[model samples]
Target: MKFKIEFSGHENIRSNHQKTIEITKESHLTPQGDCIVGVNANHACADLPQDLKEKLKNPDSKITFSIDVGEHNFTIEGKGHPDLILTHDEDIVIRKSDFVCPRTLAVKCDKASDLLPREMVSMLQDPKTKGTFTITVD
Candidate 1:
C-alpha cells in the first residue's frame, strides 16, 4: 500500500509566548505500512523563534512539534528523544484510520490555517482543523 502525506500548519506552544512554523507542502510519500512514520528532520533546530532557539537546542530539553501531516491532522510530540536519531524518530507512524475516509482521498495542507495550541484538551478539536487528509492505498 501507499499513502500521500500533506502538512497543513503547525505551532509551538511551550511557554506562554507561542511560536509557530507554517510550512507549505514540500513533498508527499506513501510507504508499505498502513501508516507511514515521518520525522520532522528539522523539528529540533529549524523554524524556531530566536528567543526559543537556545532552549530548544539543549539536548536535555524536551521539545515537541505539531504538524498537520497531509490531512492526517495530528501532532507528534518529541519527548526525551534526540533530533538526529534516524531510526528512533520513526516510532510513530500516521495511518489510514486517522482520517475521515472516502471524502478526503488525497492529502493536502493549507500552510496558512490549521493551528493547534497546547491549551486545548484535544488537538483534534481545533476549528481551523480540517479532517485528516486521505490517500489511496494500492
Candidate 2:
C-alpha cells in the first residue's frame, strides 16, 4: 500500500522550523504500511537572528499542526519537545493513533536543545508527547 504525509500550521511557525522525520511498519502483512514525514527550517532560515533560532530549538517548544492522510485527519498540538538530548539529525518517533495504523514515526528538531528547557525533556519523551486529538475519522 502507499501513504502520504501532510502538515498544516501557523505560517510563521511552519516556515521557520526544522523537522527530521521517519516512519516504519509495525505489521508484517503490510510491507508498505508505513510512511515518513521530515521537515526542517534550520539551514533554510539561517538568516534569522540568533534569538529567533534559540526559540525554535527548545525541546519543549511546540508547533501546532495537523497531519492528514486519506480520509483521516489527526490534529497535533504542542509538538517538537523530546526528553532525550536528540542530536542534530536524530529522529523523534511519533506514536500511532486510530487514524493511522500501528507504525513508528519519528521527528527531529534541528538545534532544538538551544530552545528546549532542561526540565521539559522528561515530559516530552513519553510516547504521546503531543496532546493530539483526532479531528476526523480514526
Clashes of each: 4, 17
lDDT of each residue in 1-138, candidate 2, tens digit only: 112232222111211122322321211112121222322212112232444334434445554334433343334433332232223232233332212211212223232222323223233233233222121111
Candidate 1 local lDDT, 1-138, one digit each (tens): 212333322232111212222222222332221122222223222232433433432345443334443233434332221232212211222212213121111112221122344333133223233223222221
TM-score of each model, in listed order: 0.25, 0.25
- The TM-score of candidate 2 is 0.25
Off by over 4 Å in 2: 1-56, 79-84, 88-91, 95-138
**What are the clashing pairs of model 1?**
3-30, 6-70, 71-132, 71-133
Looking at model 2, report the run of 10 residues with the lowest lDDT sum: 8-17
